[model samples]
Target: MAVWSLWSLLLWEALLPPEVTHAQVQGQVGGHALLVANRPSSFQVREAIWRSLWPAEELLATFFRGSLETLYHSRFLGRAQLHSNLSLELRPLEPGDSGNFSVLLVDTAGRAWTQTLQLKVYDAVPRPVVQVFIAVSGDAQAPKTCQVFLSCWAPNISDITYSWRREGTVDLGIEPSGLFTDGPALRVSLGPEDKSVAYSCIVSNPVSWDLATVTPWESCHREAGPGRASYKDVLLVVLPVLLLLILAGVSAWHLGPCSGKKKKDVCADEVAPEAENPLV
Candidate 1:
């Protein structure tokens, strides 16, 4: 059933006139948007009619040429303003106001033309949060180079845009990856020669924008010790194993005679002397 509804919507959009869906204007809920249009060039227009096209067609406003007053639909009272150029401005736009709208112009010569557009109203973008992660790039020229991934996002929003600005880290890799242009993420490579760096991310919608900044720590194997084991550490491990091996060899020699059939008798004879005189 849901599939059928989506199919029907696609078919409806496909059947719409090209002008009706050619462009889109975004509005912030509870904010205003100015939908602009130009005066017809051929001759003086005698009248203009603005109408909503979706959810059933309905008239929104009417303006007679050279008239001081414009008539608006009852629903649009105190919400819409009509301009001399036939442009429309809607204030305190609500989510319910999102839909297709068109304007009809009739010239004094009986010629007519129409321009249509779609509006998508959304909540204003909230302040974005910036996140950073680091990894090794292993580039040959700068071994130990760190690749930093920076992400910027706004909660509870979709279909918005992201941009980034960077500061600091002038010594090493300063140029960023392609995502820096418009993607929500960016990558930067830095080497040991590089210093600390900071990044800023800007998140925006058609109506509003917010920004966040963050500084990334160098990528590394830290906290515990050095990246490579030192010779002293290697000796500390090897010496203990060598000593244990020597002790095991000596124990095996003393126990070797006891492994065979006569071992029990020989072992007791060898141990009797030690048993009589204790080490202490």
Candidate 2:
């Protein structure tokens, strides 16, 4: 019985494909994943086979000489392709399609080479929404700069990270502990210099990223402080008045009483008209 068992083990080992280190590949839903075989082009190949082993071991495709064959009734039938170079292509990938895939390349001399890969699929992340609000610092009566809280959120995502930046500048590098809430938010004190800058929030996961931006003038609503006026607000109120004043000055210079003809000619014409009436 022991001799028979040993023989069976040897047979099983002989049938198994050669072992190689596995590699990881990442893909998104509605995309494609390619598994490349590293076989040397100079090596003559008689046949090749591709299989999947996770969830269950199943034959995926086979290549004989110059011809290719895919499993007719398999779930991957219409979406899998075997290339002449012993590479496999899976298209229109779904989340459930991620798992282990293996390729076995058989040389014309009856020797086989094999490799395995692990695939991971993720859903694309959507754009994040950012909200900003003012939070008073210390006591309300204490003359302190107001703190602004920025909240960033995305739906139906996990394992996400948040980053902040002042637009057109370097990253804000806000620490996680500086957030007002415990999650994806940031707390910052608004300095006089910050009023003219725009802040952006970036949210990301392993697969994708998104951004949202807010300007300090538009996002934070407050009564103008004693001597503080937003540059944007000042421009909005001052620019139109300045334009109107310029227009009025140009009109007066072009159309006023002294604009056309000489004053001496008018006086001479009035005196000549009186002399022509000459009853005195």
Candidate 3:
């Protein structure tokens, strides 16, 4: 019986699952930090075998090797339950911990299983900053009417470029000036037809890009009176009607004691004692 038992223990230990460890970034600030852990997989192992042939905690401890000296240990998983699983967590993790770790698992018959896992850490890209400015490229009023000037600025990024486009075929006379300035400003003029024209300035860096556009001054702002509708006109014409409809719907649905669908339809009647005294 003892010999058979020893053979079974060796066989089970030989077939143990490979142990695994990993680090996941739950959260971090300036530098990267991570959680680390080792897990065991023995779900199908019979409970009887687990109780009779499992190795001591010290033997299971031998399979793991790493220094948590500089790593900030998370207290949650430090001590593990027996015959269950094991895990270790570290936070404020730095790049130095990026390496392979070796761990061991052994069964009672002195059979051993081994596993190795690799960890890595990295820093995120920094946020880019942007600036905007305005420039004038040509005369305000010219007889040809084609020669109006304006330019815009954006943040300067290497290898990224910019260009200008107009809403209508009517040209505002944009000359590249064969010059490039690292600013987020646009300069251009609209014709009499362009009183409502839309113009835009674009800025792009290798990592990111953004746009700032200015619509025709007339659409953006109003001089008041005559053509423009007043705020009072909108409030008086639309708001009260909408509010009355909302109030009527709410009152019809929930204001009464018998408002809901399940209420009884019939009411109890009370007999009147009319003229009882005179009749009697």
* Best candidate (score: lDDT): 2
Off by over 4 Å in 3: 1-40, 43-84, 108-113, 124-127, 132-280
Per-prediction TM-score, please? 0.57, 0.65, 0.26
- Assess the local accuracy of residue 248 in candidate 2 as a C-alpha lDDT between 0 and 100: 95
Candidate 1 matches the true fold with a TM-score of 0.57
Q: In lDDT terms, how accurate is model 3?
A: 0.39
For residues 1-280, write the lDDT of model 3, one tens digit per residue.
4336435544654676544433333322233332233334533222112110111111112111221112112221333222223332334454344444433445444444444444344333222332222222245545322323344544333434454444444446663442333443444443445556655555553333555455543432332224676566777978999999999989977765454454423211122345244664
Residue 24 displacement in candidate 1 (angstroms): 4.2
Q: What is the lDDT of residue 193 in candidate 3?
A: 56
* Cα lDDT tens digits for candidate 2, 1-280: 4335334433543787564656888887798888887776676877677788886787777776577777545668799988777788889888798789887776766666777899887777778888878764445543535577888888887667777766655336653442223356777677655677777788776677788888754444463455567666799999999999999999988775544468556766767978888696
Q: What is the lDDT of residue 75 in candidate 2?
A: 64
Query: What is the TM-score of candidate 2?
Result: 0.65
Candidate 3, run of 10 with poorest lDDT? 47-56
List the candidate numbers ranked by TM-score, top first: 2, 1, 3
For 1-280, candidate 1 gives per-residue lDDT tens digits of 4335334433433454322214578899998877765444664766666777885576666666455233544455688888877788889898788888877655666555567778889888889987777653433646555667887779999878998876652446666444255788887775555445667788887788888977654333331124655456688999999999999999999877677768878888988998899677
Candidate whose TM-score is highest:
2
